[model samples]
Target: MLEEQLLQRSENKCELCQSGETLKLYAVPPQSANNVDNCIIVCDTCLSQIEKNKETEKNHWRCLTTSMWSELAAVQVVSWRMLNRLSTEGWAVDNLDMMYLDDETLAWAKAAAEDENDEIIEIHKDCNGSPLLAGDSIVLTKSLDVKGSTLNAKLGTVVKNIRLVENNTDQIEGKIEGQVIVILTKYVRKQG
Candidate 1:
């Protein structure tokens, strides 16, 4: 019944890492967020692993020679990212020479990859840990009335997982009581 039923179809584990910690629904051909063919189930670790591919300036597909044969686009995407990241590896560079992506699928993958919004902010943990990244839900420990705001946030309130403000390091933004606000990450406890 979740928007991302793909997780259930793929089973609750990350398709790549196989870790079950947190399964999330992500759009594969991110352009089609509403289409099932474009959605996939991935965990935070696998998602980050796949995301690492986008940070690279140049990509080589040799590392994915075996992966290119995968029928699943999500698998292909993950493999492509890994191959791109592995371009510096000696084996990958040599293999890149033989890697071939069909013009259509390659174009689809490339277009999907490039369309991601890198400027989007991410919230993280407040106790000197990472920022409150997206899709992480947490519970509040103390009641707080946002400064300069009229909202009455209650204590022990469950704040659905939060997203971080990309450029800011101290705030985790979330919605509570139908109002969206930025909260100190330290004030919330990560839910299991």
Candidate 2:
């Protein structure tokens, strides 16, 4: 219901980039409410980059300058978040200076970054420096002994469907011999 409303409100285009491709409902975080006021329509590119599931193209987010002035709170929140993420860029810094939000919305906009040290969203990567995401297959490049078990994960072991360890960029969880264990990302390479 809320998604339908957002879709109509956005004219079936991505509210941020105005792209009419592969739209999805992106709920503004820290609220988790499924209402129109807290959700915006986004394209696949925006969603993947926002979640750090893929590398962000800094140039792609230049649209924030226009979206920042949206009357919808959800759009403003996402715009503020993206602008903050790109704050190191000169244009982003200038737009952030010009953007304004009321006290309550400003607090909500800062919630995600406030607790993060350095305000940078961490990206998980494999030994080769390729970005890693949940459910990606990986091959162990070095042998590792399970800390509390007799199992020794051998070199060249294929660990299928790995889960990224949130809050830590250097580790991932995968099952070795039916035992789910944390593996250091440096010891594995993303499998094709």
- Model 2 per-residue lDDT tens digits across residues 62-165: 99989999999878988888887876576876687789999889888888657443285556767876767788899999999999999999999999989988
How many pairs of residues collide in each model? 14, 0
User: Model 2, which residues run further than 4 Å from truth?
Assistant: 115-192
Error of 2 at 97 (Å): 0.6
Q: Per-candidate TM vs. native?
A: 0.44, 0.60
Report how far off residue 58 is in candidate 1 (Å). Answer: 16
Model 1 regions lying over 4 Å from their true place:
2-4, 52-69, 91-100, 116-192
What lDDT tens digits, residue by residue, belong to model 1 across residues 114-171? 6663222222454534334477777777798987788878878888857877676667
lDDT score, candidate 1, position 54: 43
List per-prediction Cα lDDT, in the order shown: 0.62, 0.86
Q: lDDT score, residue 12, model 2?
A: 100
Cα displacement (angstroms), candidate 1, residue 130, comes to 40
